[model samples]
Target: MTILGFSPGEWFLLVQHELLLFAAFFFLIGAIDELAVDFSWLWLKATGRAGAPPLDSAITQKDRLSGDAAILIPTWEEEQVIEQTVSHMLKVWPQRELRIYVGCYPNDPATMSAAMAAAAGDTRVRIVIHDKQGPTTKADCLNRLYRALCEDESRQGRSAQIVVLHDAEDLVDPAALPLLDEALHCADFVQLPVVPLPQSGSHWIAGHYCEEFAESHGKAMVVRDAVGAALPAAGVGCAIARPILRDLAKTNANAAPFDADALTEDYELGLKVAEMGGQSRFLRLRDGDGRLIATRSYFPATLDAAVRQKTRWLHGIAFQGWEHMGWGTTTGDAWMRLRDRRGPIGALLLAIAYLLLALAGLTFTLEFVGVLPAIELSGGLKLLLWINLAMLLWRAAWRFGFTRSIYGWKQGVMAVLRIPVANIIAIMAARRAITAYLRSFAGVVPTWDKTAHDRHPSSFPSALDAELRFAPLEAKR
Candidate 1:
């Protein structure tokens, strides 16, 4: 079949060549962008400016902490994990100056009850029920908690030095709060590395998070901090100075600082702090025992859940983020903003690459049977492909190394194997994000797309055993 004076074989060759050139051009650009980040990270590491010194676990962090800290946990329907999370946190951190404020809706009795049960008459745990019915944005819930903290300050005649944000499903590291407190002495906003615990039931679907966060938190965040770019909060394991929060609220006419309409309020909060001239730091620390002082959590285990969670992220960070934040004036901020907004574009490229792979396979089969003529690759295209391949190998090696450092050599190997899985998920999530973003034009109000959680790290025997082993070393007072 011929059309427009071209035979079917010629048309196939033309289509393949165009697709290759298109994908190759964008991929090469993306490769260079990634290489820039890699070099920045290497420079920071080589200069001995990457992270803080490891803390001495023998010396209790609670006593060393600079000042009182208020932890704000937001919830909509997190009853299943709230009790375990709160209980474990209280048991692990036994700091007298720490207060946990749990934000719950008036209608979510189950979650409020679970939070109260976890409190068990502990004065540190304050369950603040939102006056609204249910299912408002997480940021809105967080604002209510912030207001409660302010009122508590008025009642107690004292204020918390730091305001830490967390989700109801997070597994708070005992050492994390102290580290944040210490870091707040220098930084207005501090983000701790987030390590996603491997799910026993769903390795590929959930384990991909392990690979992504390992490299992101381990290397990219270090680079961001070194280069003076704003650090985006992982939400669960980040802290902001109470003074900064108060200042932010003042900027918004003395209302609670959080943007109630934002899909990813935590992310915006960090950037907002930086935009307001507040110093932001990403703290990657370890205890003397060699355990990473970071928040660990179980991400979505099922493919549907993972896709949904990621879709919300891409929609918020890539779509709404661009609309809200825009590109700032500084070069570092602009570059970082471009990197943050690359998710959807990267996913598009991945999809095109997959399509080209299938097309290559079909072309090879046809050419072997003499049904189609072989097409010679262009010299420039060949060079571009070679460069991209080199970058891809470098990326894989780093992924393996980072994953191995966090998990083990076995999981590192799995990280390489799971690359395709991660790519596929990104593609699906980006597609859904585009649809969702477009639907917003029709006046579709964006609501929280909460990821469901069932398994908690406390449920694991090893986590329990570790807590028991460290009980003696906790706050001695």
Candidate 2:
């Protein structure tokens, strides 16, 4: 005869055990949140009243004068935005010494025609068509361009001092070139903060993008600098010294300048650079009017686009980090390697914490449905909830209260209420990413799942019709 599993008191013990595990997970999340808060506080205190030092003061005039610059734009099917993107680059950029290269595929007639039309009489812009066999990722495109640059240097006996990556959707600030050049005096690689344009018409998506940039670029990068950590390279607004790129090419001959197989090549490169012991700096750029003029691009305007973008990013970052972990050989200086390794783990842990919270909630709900005995809430859970609420308030206040100066209290309250939705989105993205990562590890090559942009092109003011017409082709060139 089968014995019944538990007595009345035994049932209580099982509930207590589950509750303890749940509380333990909550405490772990609270601890991580506390660490983040403490780090942020320390960063703010250390940088108090001390603004970012002037770039001119940080670099010598002689170094600035001697450096040669090149800007690379990699495009696939950006027909609608290419003209406006190129036009803005021509109109706002103050530098006359820049050599601009637009990388495109030969078979894409629409994009090729748009690039040609945009560069009509402009001598500075050179369109390089890659006749590759199949659809490779952006990283492959960058590797091809890098190889071309290397070959050109061999033939012409010239080398670029700095190479900048610009995206088709990015509206770069005019002062970015000089700022990067100045920063290059002190660092080998520099990344500028990027902000999303507010013209997307989806307030929720746009607001989240803005908040992310402000925290990641504005606060997090600054903190990373203070702590002497390697700053992750954002794909666009990145500038790399020729020497570093040359060395990278020589060392990783089998790999592209970026990892073609990886989803987020820019991030991988940044980590690789750090592992190699190089100094990568992030420049916080502001305009002539003293307002921050970060690069503006559109984030996903709809929910579907948002999910797709997040899924792609999550898959890329997770796979790259795991693959590199086993390589064992570290490159960049001590500070760089430590930061690179820590960053991925930190992000992974955060994601795990979010997933655990979701699981705990589900378990709690199931117990209430009588499928399982009701679990008694413990003091540890209540303590963790209070602590988490406080930390969330502090973060919200820092972003909306002090920085944005808009509805601090309201935003802080809303952020707490919206935690369920945010956590759910993150958990779903992470789950999708994990599945993709496993498939990749089992030898499946990832394809470029394209995110459709606002192809209509009528949503925003056209730069082609605005300033590109006034200046002569020669003058603009």
Among these predictions, the greatest TM-score belongs to 1
Q: TM-score of model 1 relative to the true fold?
A: 0.94
TM-score of each: 0.94, 0.79
| Tens-place lDDT digits, model 1, residues 233-256 | 889889999888999998775488
TM-score between candidate 2 and the true structure: 0.79
CA lDDT for candidate 2: 0.62
> Residues 429-450, candidate 2, lDDT per residue (tens digit)?
6666677777876998886665
List ranges where model 1 is wrong by over 4 Å: 56-59, 464-477
Best by lDDT: 1
Give residue 408's error in model 2 in angstroms: 9.8
Could you tell me how far off, in angstroms, the CA of residue 103 lies in candidate 2 after the best superposition? 1.6
Q: Which residue pairs does candidate 2 place in steric collision? A: 275-331, 275-332, 276-331, 276-332, 277-332, 277-333
RMSD of 1: 3.9
Whole-model lDDT per candidate:
0.86, 0.62
- State the displacement of the C-alpha of residue 53, model 1, in Å, after optimal TM-score superposition: 3.3
